[model samples]
Target chain A: MGKIKILNPGLLSTIQDGGRFGYQQYGMPVAGAMDLHSLQLANWCVRNPAHEACIEATILGPTIEFQSDTYIAISGATIQPFVNEQAINMNAGIKVRAGDVLSFGSIQTGCRIYIAIAGGFDIPELMESKSTYLRGNLGGFEGRALKAGDELEIADYERRLKGVVPEELIPNYSNFTEIRITSGAEIKRFTMDGVKTFLCSVYSISPQSDRMGYRLSGQKIEHANGADIISSGIVTGAIQVPGHGEPIIMMSDHQTVGGYTKIAQVISVDLPLLGQMKPGDQIKFKEVNLDQAQQLLLERNQWLKQHGIE
Target chain B: MIEYIPSGDSAFLVKFGNEISEEINRKVRAYFIALSNKKLEGIIECVPSYTDLMVLYDPLKIQYKSLLKELKILAENISEIEIPEAKTVEIPVCYGGNFGEDMDAVIAHTGLREQEIIEKHSQNSYLVYMLGFTPGFCYLGGMDKSIATPRKEVPSQKILAGSVGLAAEQTGIYPIESPGGWQIIGRTPYRLFDPNRKPEFLLQAGDYLKFYPISEEEYYKLNEND
Candidate 1:
């Protein structure tokens, strides 16, 4: 099988796909790529189906050597992906020769970068996905982040895949972002004044944040009754408030259930932005009705379909 | 009251009740099984907790109102839904000493002798409320309040998998190594979660779990096979 040999596994690089579902019933988390949109965008360049397994790297990235010729694409975060010190363009398919070394430079914009090959990663699928759940040591290239000396096989495919994301379709990864969220199921659990304060607050992403959830520190919102709730299902992007009154936004690797009261859920369209945010980035919440939030999701999907990349 | 609450754009939170009990959880499991049997279009996944069943769906395939309408119809006669009989699983736990670091703390907190604490913990059967918080981590209910203790002020940075612990009125097993505040009383030899194995999880919701005390030698002897 064709392979990519890892030379240096930068910060936190792992294989990920759409997500592992249907297993959440058994207490499993739906671990997937932090930025599904960017993963899909990179897959688009490689002519693979959307949601194919790809390498997800944090702000820093890995140095890898191609063991065979294939088309590769880089998307999200300007990591300055280079082949033998020669820079490659982002969002476009680039051809590589056997033994060519690909390394990354400092992150220029986004917090995460997705790297996709022509035929996707050839890791064994567990629970119908290649995404890694680090906590459980399940799935994805031996259930953990990539390391130096690990050889990852890629599916066999041949094509100088030609694709490029349109300017408007690219994500804007500014330090300060305004995210839109809909009221959570337990919205009334918090004081009306608390809800208003959340909308008006500008929170800085806490340093402790990771794939499981993003911790935000800002104004402490008041709970009408208390912060505790009967443990219930927690969806990705749900902003849960605990006794501390601080909000924790669930992310791709969020657990199946939580006991804290969730104040709101970030709209689906805006979720990808959370994946690209780094520690200390300022975020402010905006309110959108459920109808408007769903509309935004549909519009985003429509755009992807319109571009023949759905 | 059965209420349909808003979650996010792609899902709906259908709450059965506001509290955790066998009666309410049975309803959750019944609906989970019912929704599973429906093979409903656009429904991605259904996760049942103590009192809520969150149905995640694909907005591109079905709208919120349409899915809500379908869910209401299915829920109208939900209590009548037949659920599978509960399965009883017996777990052998070795309590106190190194296997249970917080055993002394628990004994002090409850003011009970070591043997009494062990007997009380193992004697009562706990209902598997839900399998969550971590993969294959069973949310057990019905721990004897005599041994009930509050969670530690500072959660351990890493609690090993298969550690049986107590928090408030609950006793749970850590299916995987994770940071937790539960007071550890014992450790189990059983691997509650093994991804490579068929079935993956040792316990599921709608099951009964009874713990039996085991000697340290027996714990290592049983664990050696795995």
Candidate 2:
């Protein structure tokens, strides 16, 4: 079996794929990579399936020692990925011999980086996924983040071929981003002033944000009624408003149900931008109709297919 | 009246009512069972909550408007949907000790004696509204308001699995160790969530859960037996 030995597990790294779906009814969250587009691109660089599990490294990355020759690609964050002490171009497949050391330097941009290896990470698949849900202690490597000296097994592949992800597809992880949103079920619950405040004001990402939610601190939007509502199913990117008037953007690891009133849902096409945002980043929401939001999603899928990445 | 709205690009929210009630819950379960039997193309899964159902689907295979139309038809005959009989599950709980770290806080807030609190808590059967917040965690309703308490000012960093807690007007069980703000009153020895098990979760939505008190020694005995 081919393997990679961890020498220095950077700030935080976990295994993720598409996500754990079809289990939200059982109180299970669909934990997966924050940025699905980047993960898919990384997998494409290795000629693997789109859902293959990869390593999601935070601002800092890990130092890994490969035990066998394989093809690998780095995407998302502009982490200066190096093999054997030399920098390598990201978004392009790179071949390495056994005993080669792979490491990363300072992050050039973005908060999370993805590394996809040939045949993907051969971790135990839970609920048909290898993504890690940290709170539940399920999936991924021992159901937790990677640590130094932990051995990870990669799927064994005989022939390693070079692949490329077009340069234009790479995203610029800007600190200030404009996120698009569609009105939510409870969109009418907010007063006109509240709606205006939400749309016009800039919100800074709170430090207490995580995979479960991104709490944004900005001008308090007054609601017509109280913020409490009947507990209902919450989708990813749902922007919930609690009684305190702060907005919380649900992410991939969001709970299956929540009682807070939701004002808007971030457009599916802009979720990758939200995923790459770090604490203290600024975000301004732009309102779009449901048709426009759905159209954007369709366009994204079509683009991915056109590039042969999905 | 039932209304289906787009939750996002890939899912739709099927809302049954504006408030939480057994009648609404039954409708959610009925429709969930009925929809699951449909095996609709592109329909991934349906999650039943207190007053709504989240129908996740693959937009590539089925359009949201088309799925909404199908759901509207299904909602028309929801009451006629045949749901399985609700199962009564008995859980043994050990009250007030190291296991229930926040037991004192609960007693202080309720002004009821420890035994009275336990009796009131264990008397009525709780309806499992849904399993959410964490794996195998059940959001139980029908707790007697006499002993109801608010969540802690600050959430604990870690609460043990199987710990039974009460917050606001609800009682719940933590399936895994995680951060929470509930006032714990007891612990059940039975495992609520086990990934190795066939169903993974011990209790599902629409199940009735009854609690019985046990001695601390008996709690350990049950754990040892498992």
Candidate 3:
């Protein structure tokens, strides 16, 4: 058992696992970590299950004090994390002795970060998940962002006495900024010119983006008809265009049902890439077939397993 | 009959039509029951919405093509299957005054007396078409056209739980406190959604609902009893 004390809860930080599934029938959103890839990588570094509960730090991160000796890993955005004012390396497992102070600087590229502990953060599960839903106040640390002075308990698991990390298991965060997308159900609703514009033009992430969805500011994609779609189940990476042609990519905390016409869907393999993007970052969408998307995901899974992450 | 389309990488949607109709609603409910009982492997959940049913599945376990093929078969088989009998529930509600603030607006829109509207609404048995918009919020069918009214232009910041309201052709009870635009006529004391409870939701889709008007004293007494 171990404890972590928060000294400076950053912009937004919350405990998250995989997600809440099988509850969308009751209008519950599948609230989970935005950047799942980073979460998995962080957990892998700590020798924990990839889906184990971890801290999802947004923009910046809180100053933390370790109450006991534990192994930890940091992934996602280059936040320039430090321990006792010394720069800590990103994407590598490190042992933290008791009373060590950890702090994070402003995001240099991405918007989010994941901090994983050896045994994972201990939080009550709701609907088979530890992810937080702020709107419903359902899971993870009272279903809200972590605050200063907050203490978190770490689950008990078999720990490795010797700190052993493979050299090649480290992830390259530089190439993940680009996002890939697939054609959505309402893709045909947009004009041929609109589709061309979507694929060709570059857009910037709007400041209004959050866990619910990322609102992008770019050239308005014109639709052929003024059709209002019925509210239906939406998934992460669904690029929904409301009355205004500006697209919003639905994320983890997005509503179970949405009425906007979805023009494109960010491919599952590239959703993590989008998750790392911060406001003002330039983004370009490249179209890919479903088969390619599936292949990419399979390749990613194989890569993880090959590196000792099951 | 409706067409099933791919929603995303992990789900498919069966859309009935653009307009709302009783026949289509019943078809959707029956199909939902059929699919639930079929129990396809890798299928995580099936959610019935206003005019569509969304099916979520584990992409790692089941390929998209095979799942779509199975759904197509299910859609073809839905017409021959019988829908299960729905449980009948009698819900007690307190009309107007404090609990329902939009009673006057509903009365004005319908151009009917408040008592007459209450009598009409309480007289008919409503069918739970779906549960959505919020946890335990039951989307009910069978509202008399005479009392049918449009939703508020500006939605209220907080509509109390169990507040029964009408929006266009549909009427529903708010299971949780949320921002809504429906014209509320009454509020129920029974908890619609309690996470501590075994089932969580008090009602499910396809359930039969009968609203019984109660006094303010009765509402408080029942609340205290629970």
- TM-score list, all predictions: 0.93, 0.93, 0.92
lDDT of 1 by residue, A56-144 (tens): 99979889999999999999886788998998888998899899999988997879999999998888899889999987788899999
Give the winner by DockQ: 1
Better of 1 and 3 by TM-score: 1
Residue-wise C-alpha lDDT for candidate 2, range B27-110, written one tens digit per residue: 888888889998999998778899888898887788777888899988887667777888989999999888788889988998
Cα lDDT, all candidates: 0.90, 0.88, 0.81
**Candidate 3 collision pairs:** none
- Among the numbered candidates, top lDDT falls to 1
**TM-score (0 to 1) of chain B, per candidate?**
0.90, 0.92, 0.85
Q: What's the CA error at residue A175 for candidate 2, in Å? A: 2.1
Candidate 2 lDDT tens digits, A1-310: 7899999989989998989988889988998999998998888888888878999998898999999889999889887889999999899889988999999999877888889999988888888789999977789999999999999999987586677888778988888999999887798889999999999999999999988899999999889999988788888999999999999999988998888888998888899889999899999999988778878888888888898878
Docking class of 1: medium
Instruction: Residues B1-226, candidate 1: write the lDDT tens digits.
Output: 7899879898899998988889999888888888888899999998888998999999989999999999999988766777678888999999999989999989889999989999999998889888887799888888899999899999999998889999998899988888999999999999888887788888888789999999999999888223
lDDT of 3 by residue, A91-171 (tens): 778888889999988777777889988888877787778998888877898878899999999876566432334546533
Which has the higher lDDT value, candidate number 1 or candidate number 3?
1
Q: RMSDs, each prediction? A: 2.3, 2.4, 2.6
TM-score of chain A of 1: 0.98
